[model samples]
Target: MTQLDTAPARLSPAEPSVAEPPAASAVARLTTASPLGRIVVEGDGSAITRLEIERAGALSTDGLPDAPDDLTRRAVDQLGEYFSGSRHDIDVPVRLTGTPFQRAIWEGLRAIPFGATRSYGELGRDTGRATAGRAVGGAVGANPVPLIVPCHRVLASDQRITGYSAGDGVPTKVWLLDHEGIAHR
Candidate 1:
């Protein structure tokens, strides 16, 4: 998959340890979601800015003046195109500012492939950190971008699917897994 004209330089985190992101300016923002909640994706001049899932109508652009305005609409539009199978990859720029380990996990998640999946353990191996299955699970759960990162493609070792903080519940996760033909119960 190719990144778009606006692809960020480092979708991956910068260090091997967890650290806070330095304050930066954003260039755009927008949101999209299932019936359960709303997810707002923002971007800086060159990468994604925010990927927070919020309660329905939770966005109160009341006073947060720096909130992005450009990329959010792009994220929503592209996401809609994705669900419809008209687009195969997320081409918009994304920053995914987080810990280095989280960035590693996200990178692995990025390779989960369309209509495919991996167990936590499987992802651990693919990430070249076999001992980090639980850690990978933690990162997967913490994923701000789901369908984009395709976190629903990760499953448990028991061959059962679980844990999704976004959307209404596990049903969306299950439906997504099923849609991918992951063979789960």
Candidate 2:
């Protein structure tokens, strides 16, 4: 029999604490209930940095002011309209944080017109990498902002559903696509 060794790791004194992010990266967050569940929006006064659907937990916004800025308010309102099927587009500015390829993929995703979906191969071709469908899929999967970037509009080559990173996964994706009147294979 082999014996396993376990020991606690020690942190260097110069290292920053991992419990909280740096002051410059500190974000104010707000939570709103949607048809899908709670949506957490994080940003400062300028742009929305992150938007995530919470399936298991909620971010507390107890003492925080309700949408302290116009951008946040617009985001919440647009999301509301989107869920209600009254709005088909979102106009709020998003502060995209990712690599150049990821940003390009996100731009391509945004270009997928409402109620329409494109295959991963088609999206790759549109991004000027016709032979890089797998690479395109990787970037698509890395999308941090889902609904805003519209990554769900990208599908498999057979026009079938694929992976989704938010709100109940593929089922939520189906609901969103259905809400937009998109028919998939």
TM-score of each prediction: 0.71, 0.78
What would the per-residue lDDT of candidate 2 be over residues 1-185, giving only the tens digit for each residue?
11111111111112111222224555656678898888877765555767888655543444566544566667788889989889777766566656656666676777777898888888777768899977888888777667877888888887799787777788888888888888886
lDDT, candidate 1, at 82: 65
Q: lDDT of model 1 at residue 165?
A: 58
lDDT of 1 by residue, 58-154 (tens): 6443235445455566667776676666765666655465565677777777766777777888878876889987788888887756666778878
Would you give me the overall lDDT of model 2?
A: 0.69
Best by lDDT: 2
Q: Give the Cα-based TM-score of candidate 2 against the true structure.
A: 0.78
| TM-score of structure candidate 1 | 0.71
- Computed on alpha carbons, the lDDT of every model, listed in order, comes to 0.63, 0.69
- C-alpha root-mean-square deviation, each candidate: 5.8, 12.4
Clashing pairs in 2: none
